[model samples]
Target: MKRAAELELALAPRAEGVTLQRWLCGELRAAILAGRLAPGCRLPSTRDFARQQAISRGTVVAVYDQLIAEGYLSGATGSGTTVAAALPIAAAGTAQPRTSAAPGIARAAAADTAGTDDAATKRPRLSRQGQLLANSPFLSREGMVLGRPFSPNQPDLGAFPHALWQRLTHQQGRGLRPDDMGYGDGAGHQPLRRAIAEHLRYSQRIDCHAGQVMILSSAQQALDLCARLLLDPGDTALVEDPGYPGAARLFELGGARVQGVPVDRLGLCTDALPTAEEARLAYVTAAHQSPLGGTLPLERRLALLAWAEAGRRIIIEDDYDGEYRFDGAPLPALKSLDRHDRVIYLGTFSKLLFPALRLAYAVVPEWLAEPFASAISLTVRHAPILPQAVLAAFIGEGHFARHLRQMRRLYGERAACFQHECATQLDGLLTVLPITTGLDATALLPRGSDDRAVAAALGAWGVEARPISFYGMGQPAPPGLVMGFSACNEAAIRRGVATMAPVLESFNAAAAGNRGQAVAGV
Candidate 1:
């Protein structure tokens, strides 16, 4: 028997929201199951473990009692404690116990659910739609190293006015009404809805009132609610190729057939929009095409509206990063062109304020407002009210506008620096596309060059460049890197570009050599 002093048992620091006893039990159980604690191995006294871990002896005793009840450990008044000799997990690498005298081992095993049959422990089956959502790329953490240089669609979190936001938060907390402490309205705080309505009207010529706005957790939530409310299984939903994967995933989650329409320099090609017979809905990033930063042209916008009107179809216009257009006067949102009231416009504070805020707004037609809000209520109730109130105050007091102006200028400078550095450093390797609006920009790789491979190579070097191919659902777009400069400062952008240059050059050279070899073989 190993001495208690030689056991070297330790507990990991407890995680938030978990009790000390539960944490200790989980760690000890893991040790037993992984064969780290052999069968018949004596455990330290609860008093000794409590002293070593700086936890209460009662908690350690409780954990041991619980583990014993679950058949993981065997203990008696005088026998101290030992790992269960007859644990069923022995076949899975845990050693069989050398001693069978441990008290209540058999009785505990019979009582414990852990000894249940394999069929009882199998994972629950998912529905077909649930399977698609489960395997979604949107949930993938690949290339999602936050604060890394050129991480696509990421805003400059370092530049957010944290002090100002905290001040507003504190003010809201102080002024909260008793009603504010309760579950909030499904449509969100009235003041925030009004503020958003006013801001949209003034900035984007969107004709809306507070009644038409529904605030939810994030743009994804808003889209999910839209999918739940609007799409039926086997129905067709049109999404742009090389567009937001999250939206497509949401629509697919509702069992809708997500058909990707092709996009070009001017955004989604209106000429290619199929007749809206089976198509129930269309989603577009009209302000600036996602992955490829091109504003939808007025001609295409009018044509799209015409298409929706002709078929009584719903159009979801995601103006996700429309706030920072550096080129010309901002175009009115596709929502503003909805004479037929078929457009549901979505906007997010995640891009504008910060991602962690997790607040976004949706402007639906009068007919759909109640249902939409009800769906949100039935789903998530609503976004936290205090943050909603604070954002309302932020917009009403002019801080939102001030911040927008500051970010636009800062991001513009970063964009320019990024493009210049790309031109100087990656001249022969790739071409950085012209940036007009949005946080990220696309840089097309040399024709036939492997964008995914290049992106992987760059990721290994600490640069997070998402390949554009990851966004496509249909015909592939040009091999390109969707790199963001907004999250990275000018120096980091320059450094990122410098790092990418040599790697791209080597790949390009190899590709050329491979082409020569192919031609020689032919």
Candidate 2:
């Protein structure tokens, strides 16, 4: 008969100030590595584990996440967690001694072999400066640390229906059949595709059938698939000057020669499109332009569509945050008006649901749908089935619409509070760039001020705001900080900005001192 033992006894002593969650994770990891726990062995339930370890259930969950991320365990919906099938092992045998040959011949052979090995192992060199900058873009760095982020593109996570999601997830598990656990449809869950089609029709006035919507991992993937389908190595693609970096990077990486088209208040100047040669694709965020946050006027939209038809170019419209319009009624997506079948519309649930969900869809023109679907299937097979299923259920059950309504109210209040605070506190010190729609909130800093330095100082106070310069295509941009008000509450907004005021003042004083020094030196 096999014997069962108490794994809890193997735990190490807890260090002072270390979280119980961390300690439990460390103990569980050690027990697994020591082989006290074997592959296929089930973990105790969260409640049972917490009782056994004399810790909270939350602590157990954190430990489980750590183990899962480390590849030590696997988790299923109804089934309890179990150990992974295999663990990495180091070779046990010692190295064999080399036999001697003629010194010159051995040296020559060794050099040749080493040269070949080095060549094989060589990786694409990432530029050091580029890597450093890329690690955290100006927007990401500032937004992550600033006390009250005033940048756009932030979502109100607190208002998300976590309890409802948990309940739905449990319900899904209870009703899911055995076959549902296997690989799903390559395009996406059929129900999800249908649900999205209905959603686009009702919400965005899009005229797409479920078959036209192809699920992708993200808008980035959508862009990648589009680039692959439309662009060749030497092909030219037009990108907005101040656009989403995610789209710009994807196009460049696909070997398309990218040209930046300037944006005025009307958004992506169609007349400014380089006429030197015909381009294969033009990428635009017409609904709510990135960084500048201007909605493309209807006339300009028609002009862009006309331009695309004239040049036989495909227009990639990224309507990333289309649902969050605060002023007037939401406009129809560009794809809705593409009678010529020249526009490929990209939309994402990332902003609406959460960034971690990694669920997005692309509406391909009738002519391109087959090719795009084929490319997606060949590349990633499809987006994961579970998220699609959950989202479909969420939408079908009307939870999605309800959630959006709730979030819209919350975000509107927060935005109002942020704008009021900015006007009252900063006054002439900053210029609040008008954002009448969507989730973007931008404010230009004093001219000649180091926006990067100001953002860093705000980070010291625990407020995260993105710098506008990070969004520029080429050359330095105007001094400004892009603040996202969606995630914070009125109190947090007030506190964060109140904390940031002194930092800005101090920065301004330092700048004046530096200028005085420069003038004296001259």
Best by lDDT, which number? Answer: 1
Can you write out model 1's per-residue Cα lDDT over 1-522, one digit (the tens) per residue? 668756776444566776676667767765675567888888999888888888899998898898889888899888899888887765454232222232233234334435557534553588887787678685544537987888887888888989998999999999998977998889999999999999999789999999999998888888989999988999999999988899998998888999999999789998988995899999999989987878898999999999999998999999999989887656899999888899999999988989888899999999999999899889888888888989999999999999888899998899899989988988978888889888998899989988889999999988888888888888679999998899888778888899998889899999999999999999
Q: Which stretches of candidate 2 lie over 4 Å from their true place?
A: 1-152, 513-522
- What does candidate 2's lDDT look like per residue over 1-522, in tens digits? 332223344455676766777666655655565455677777777877788778888878887887899788888998878777676520111111121322233343345445465534553466743563365433453336322455456677666889988888888778788898887666788899899999899888999899888888899889878877888877889888776676666666667788888886557887787655548889999888887777898888998888888888899999988687776557888888899989989989878888778899988888887888778879888788777888899999999988777777777777788889988998767787776666668788888987878877777777666677767787346788887888777888888778878888887788789999999999
C-alpha local distance difference test of each model: 0.85, 0.76
Tell me model 2's lDDT, rounded to 2 decimals: 0.76
RMSD of each candidate? 6.6, 13.0
**Candidate 1: stretches off by over 4 Å:** 1-121
- RMSD to the native, candidate 2? 13.0
